[model samples]
Target: MNSKEFLNELKKYSNDLLVSMSFDQIFKEELLKLYPRKIINCHAGKLPFYRDRNILNWALINNEKEFGISVHFIDKGINTGDIILQKTYEIKDSDDYTTLLNLCHKECASLLYESLILFLEDNVKAYKQKRKKKGGGNI
Candidate 1:
């Protein structure tokens, strides 16, 4: 019913790390405080850029030539967490939302895996995400 109660329940589980991709829900202060940098997320879109959902379509509708993926520490803000890794994939004229989404599926998995390794090894170096620029993600 509260932070302490929730934490006690969590302690019953042996999960040492929390990383997400399909989890679009926002984590408030209490949960965030539990993990700090240990709470990570592989965002489907570029942080502070194409936030929320429908990112692939946003990129396509905006006539973007590239699609981006970011793995970051999940902060209280909406996808405004510190970035662990960010990489973009080219979007050719023939590509559509479905294609971009598929690309993100692969890229997100790869990036998340790489990030987790770095985290477990204590080799991670996170950087604050900059403010949002124009739509369609910053290049």
Candidate 2:
């Protein structure tokens, strides 16, 4: 389903969950204020340095040493959120875009599933992020 369809369905269940539907930046700011818990998002690539699109393409082009997925809180800027979890897989020198993408997709799926499990069991605190830091560091 498209974003509009998905959002419409989400709105139908608003009573069971918080719902805010607006493209305006102020709406997002308002959400940040009203929501008590963290706001999460799944980034397709390792964040900070790899902030642009088509990360798989970029990773292959640049011949990266590693690639990964990150689950992070959504802040004001792009991919600047506090990282809740990250999982990386080494990039083989001979690896191409397709292979690297498969690895990234696998990690993303695992992390997403794990995050949902934690949310349901109320053990999300197990992966609580450390203090937010600037850009990419050792990981």
Candidate 3:
């Protein structure tokens, strides 16, 4: 849980690194000397909206019609990253929080895997998602 252990473990992964710190708590001193590269995060909500936690819950509560996943570049602002790729799915009225979340999680994992493959192949830059611009998702 501490910084030293966290950084050490992160260094073990190839092409993947983990930093155990709140976005606000991560300081430049901890990473300034390290390699400067694009850092991306997959989010459950669409960008410029639904920017915080419990995305699926929010979608269900708001009665959205569709929900999707977004892979984007991390920026100083939350959920404001430049989108790389997005995949969406229809939300059924019978879908609850758990169902919606499970679906979104599956899509997120797939997107990340596909994006990594694309990056390795030098075939793409990033993905951008476009959500349904209508009513909220099913409750």
The TM-score leader among the candidates is 1
User: What are the lDDT figures for the candidates, one per model?
Assistant: 0.81, 0.60, 0.63
Rank candidates by TM-score, best first: 1, 3, 2
The C-alpha stretches of model 3 lying farther than 4 A from their native spots are 1-35, 127-139
Better of 1 and 2 by TM-score: 1
What are the candidates' C-alpha RMSDs? 2.9, 5.8, 5.4
Model 3 lDDT tens row, 10-63: 567664422221143432334422423346677787665676777788888778
Which prediction has the highest lDDT against the true structure?
1
List model 1 lDDT by residue over 49-68, tens digit each.
88777788778888887867
Decreasing lDDT order of the candidates = 1, 3, 2
Superposed by TM-score, candidate 2 places the C-alpha of residue 54 at a distance from the truth, in angstroms, of 1.7
Q: Which stretches in model 2 have alpha-carbon errors above 4 Å?
A: 1-39, 126-139
The number of clashing residue pairs in each candidate reads 0, 0, 12
TM-score of each: 0.87, 0.65, 0.70
lDDT of 3 at 130: 46
